[model samples]
Target: MSLLVLLFAVIPITEMLAVRLFSGIITDGPGQFAANPLRVVWQIVVFFLALAVTRSAHHLIKIVRVRVFRSGFQAAGSGVPPNKESWQWAVAFEMSNVSSAVVQIAMFAALFFAFDPITGIVGAVVAAASLAAISWLYQRQLRLQRDYLETRWTPEAVAIPDRVGTRIKHSEIGAFVGTAGLLVTLIVVFARVLGGQIVTSDAIVLFLGLRLMFGQFGTLSSGAMRFARAAVHL
Candidate 1:
């Protein structure tokens, strides 16, 4: 899972860096005016970035499910083993994340094409809030189902370690906030160096996805460490 996260995060940063560098060469050349090919080139670039963003979002959902299952299993063995049920929940979450991303990108693209950066950012926040709210509701429904199952089975209950859940929670939040801040700073610096033309609201949406991906990667990687710690302490 750590390897997967590293791959997802590194690939995009590398791809974006490469694209930025190539764009620089194209724009700076003597015949820069002649380089105006179709906008397809930009479209292709954004498509790849969106793919990476989607993967990260999917991975985060996977981590969240894994954690929940572990918590549920510890709470009550029930019928399914925690790890097994966790994967099931992860698959369900991944599907929902994909649907959410499509809606997010569409909404962001529409608003970005319509408004200025400030308005676009406001729209992105609203869109993100809506996405998060929907996801939360889905998870809540799943929780109720899990509770019903646990009650039916009446498996032995055990306390989950704070380290198992709390650390991952903190790590996820920190990574998200840190990554978002970094992206914002980078965009500001890029705007200064390359000019304000690059400061579109679309970039903000992409950064939001990037931060979300890293946060999931961090949380998933932490879960394995928590399991190891539990074994060692026992």
Candidate 2:
């Protein structure tokens, strides 16, 4: 879990640094890089180093997840019944979905703090409200999923009804739209309120950071929906 958290945190920071480097080159011109060649090289090296760490962490986490799953399945013995599909979904929900949602939530919080306290507070409220709405919808969808699974247990059939699937799609779409809209509003607010006080690089970082933060939100939302489906089986 620590490795997972570190992996998530490093990803956004590495992305932000890459964006910052590119933006700096564009804003300051190629002459700056030419003047400080060593600095540019150092930044590039750091980026690659971080990339290596991220890959290593991801690989290690995958190994750990597999081992844990194997151990749990072995412990369950006859009770588990050796359903490949069931076991796969259980492992996904237990390891990937839950950990990703948690790490994403923490990343969003950290991104909120990147701006200001007021924005952080506002983000917290928005996050809570959005999650509550999604949770309520998911509860309804879960009921539908349970009903569908109870009656439709074919090997090749669709897992959910059209209505439920449509709702799930809309929920994901709504999350993206909400995230984009919120970030847009923040950009406008910062522009009007802060005026020339904010640098171009800062604006770029804000955009990228928000993108990463809410991209994770979209993932987290999708994971939650998957969990709803997986829950019926568990």
Q: Highest lDDT among the candidates is held by which one?
A: 2
Overall local distance difference test of candidate 1: 0.44
User: How many clashing pairs does model 2 include?
Assistant: 0
lDDT of residue 232 for candidate 2? 78
* Residue runs of model 1 more than 4 Å from their true location after superposition: 30-127, 140-234
Alpha carbon RMSD to native, model 1: 13.5
Q: What tens-digit string does per-residue lDDT give for candidate 1 at 37-147?
A: 445456446656656665675566556655654566567755755556655455434533343333333443343434246434643554454335434433443453344
Question: Which stretches of candidate 2 lie above 4 Å from their native place?
Answer: 29-31, 55-63, 75-78, 84-88, 115-121, 151-164, 177-185, 188-194
lDDT of 2 by residue, 45-88 (tens): 77567667656755766677666566666776646445655845
Compared to the true structure, candidate 2 yields what TM-score? 0.74
User: Which consecutive 10 residues in model 2 have the weakest lDDT in total?
Assistant: 89-98
Total clashing pairs in model 1:
0
Using TM-score as the measure, the top candidate is 2
